[model samples]
Target: MTIPAPTHQDMLAISERLGLGITEEQSKIYAEVVAKSITTYGPVAEISAEDTPLRPAGGSREHTVPTAEDNRHNAWFVRSSITEKSTGPLAGRTVVVKDSIPVAGLPMIAGSNLFEGYVPDFDAEVVRRVLEAGGTVSGKAHCEYLCFSGASHTNVTGPIRNPWGDGYSTGGSSSGSAALVALGEADMSLGADQAGSIRMPSSFCGIVGLKPTTGLVPYTGIPSLDAEFDHVGPMTADVADNALLLSVLAGPDGIDPRQHGVEPSDYQGALDQGVKGLRIGVLKEGFEVPGTQRAVAERVRAAADVLARLGATVHEVSVPQHRLGLDIWSTIGWTGMTETALRHNGIGIYRDDHYPVSLMEWAHRHGSAIDQAPPSVKLFFVISEYVTKHIGYAGYGRGVNAARVLRGKYDEILKDVDLLLMPTTPMTALPLPDPSSGIEDELRTSHPMAFNTAPFDITHHPALTLPCGPGDNDMPVGLMLVGRHYKEATVYRAAKAYEDTGEGAFRP
Candidate 1:
């Protein structure tokens, strides 16, 4: 097959399609200029045999390792378990990193055929922190394909079911991270949340997950959805473990732009402070939504009563804009994430890049991975491409502005309350839908799952989800507490307060 360059006629047609009025002569000139530019810059410089390969940025393992057992739970994509006997805060803990985050020499599928068999040459910042703190690197948890869906079935590995209920969904894209911890496959795990991935699964699986303030935890080596919205945090079976993990992971790595100029805090120091005098604001709109489950809502309200009994005041606070959080998240995420996915290779947002260039190039030879991705990922790309091309991405900017306005509303309310409380998801985990379900069905089931958690991702606030005991069919319910940006200590304090009740964070 011969590659064809764009003709002057093609250029003219494109200009017309874009509503640019240009003469034939101008089109001809611009087409030739573009051809010349491509010819001049398309080829990379040739390397000599003497040239050295890029050195691995961090410590190295002997070689990539594989899982000892590949089982039905499908919770883990790779298992290269490592236990170092050093003593530190996380000593004797075995933790897994979400497949989207790199762990040196471990095969990371990232729950997509797009990244199958890719292994990083270096560990992610969080992985290094866990190892240095004496925690064991158990494996890489399977995530949703491209980390785009809130359902577990979207991954290449099939569904990651809730440990609590055999066929129920483990609210995702951090499915395996929560599943493994909930099942005791690992003591704790690292999860990445772009739009509620961490907290949603934590909610479904009855664990504790924290989406730290945007810049509070460095996102250096995690595969990104959007740098601005990307967050990496800890998921554990209890609040104390979560806080201890957060203490280790929170700090500047001097490389991630998100962590630039940010100071670290002692998260563990304030966790036991309790919510004695803290005022908790229950966001009225969060529970009054159309399909909000009564059982889940009642559990969250009951959780507020528990907090109130612990000496915290619970007030019904209304932030109407909170309802638009899902819409805004969609408007901003669809276009931005589609752009990144279309890039095919890894997005170059972090230092010490570990792009699976060979695997991606090979996959490209067969077909575009975007075209083959699961429904949610495909829908995002197709719709975003059309919307951005024809209707323009004006909504993306408006969405950003709306996020600030929403943040202002929360901040204003925060002036009168210490933290905002709500359900982590609109309902408890739903039964796993059929694989052949329509996109509409998937969207219908998943659209509201992030309503309560996506807002904080947009506003850069610290939000935490802790189990509020069982609800609706005895499935777990999650109560979320949102704090001011970088105020995760307060979020943890309140969560720890609930955990102290000895009723939350159930283990299956």
Candidate 2:
């Protein structure tokens, strides 16, 4: 079918929007020219690819058992028993993929009804690797709506209560991933982290979580925040399990483009190495954030001493720029959030970013459900859109530049120390905020959660969080160990050394 030609009125509107002051006569001429160009191009090609193996060695899995309707922790979107290759490192281990990452044949709600009934016909690279490596795909874990909110209370399935017991938060958007692992519902889970999503929930629920160096684990087939900040890694009950999962998940998929030239690592190789002779820098800014509970600080300091006693040298390191991380991250991250949320609608440039085209088209069909997004996402959409309109995307550019400065500050400190140690969160898990509460209360939930964790997302460093010990009210505190880019092996080793001392144990 030939394309419909644009009317003179349509051309006038387009010209006015572009600041082209063409008169009525010029509008007719320009409209014909534009119509001819569109006609020559024919209809817009469907962005969705057919259901076939796109990446080599991308095996499939049988959805043997269907997802259960409900569960104790409200942590899973779909609970099924699935495995393909039965003999590998992760054999017999049950795992959940966060709902934001595709796992073919399963309903990936992404914690929102906006994508109901939208099942992908292909698996995410990480999901494929898990099946091939003999890991069982247990279910889809809950994430915050569109994986935006850091608080666990924002999911459409229901609020993910903390495993530490009632009333407390299981910091999110990877809410159920941490909750399930912490409560022993699953052995391990894959979590995508844009701004501390994996680590925040892990810290809140007292599990071990690693946000690998960006681009280390391919973001292919996962709904993303932005290509620059996207990452996927493992959340588990212990450092050993986390390391084991990373060994399987890390590597190029040959299709992500971001992973094209990247070489993978043997993450399990240095796990048993003691932290002897290692220099650990305790970040000063990490402890100075307002609202940091006294016990949370004391607990992290005590862990630093434990590393010292275990033969690692520990000292204080200051990076003043870190004080600006939240602001810088808010500017860039929220702006990117808006761009990504609307990108499939042709609202922005398509940079060949990793997105499930089929799932997106399904979402488009059910797009009206987007109004059900929580207050946090609504706030982000409104504010990010307003800022972009007023400031013309220059704020995002400035934010990226500021992030580079912050990354340089971290690099300067890392040059003198093997790893940077800090509290994973400024405070232990706080009580879940009332859903009907005012915006001020809702904002309070995430303000202190990612102060330390978000910076690494910006810098693309490998950061791991593990249980340190109980803090105020017996809530668990996390000791975060951050390593240079692609040095997750060193991060794992330090975390394992701490784990060996039995200081980070949480048997809930």
Which candidate number maximizes lDDT? Answer: 2
Clash pairs, candidate 2, are none
TM-score (all chains, Cα) for each model: 0.87, 0.92
- Which digits, one per residue and each the tens of the lDDT, describe model 2 over residues 108-163? 77888787777777788898889889999998888888888888888887788898
What candidate 2 gets wrong by more than 4 Å, as runs, is: 1-36, 39-70, 345-355
RMSD of each: 4.2, 3.0
Full-model lDDT, candidate 1: 0.80
Error of 2 at 480 (Å): 0.3
Q: After aligning candidate 1 to the native by TM-score, how far in Å is the CA of 85 from where it should be?
A: 6.9
Give all candidates' CA lDDT scores.
0.80, 0.83
lDDT of 2: 0.83
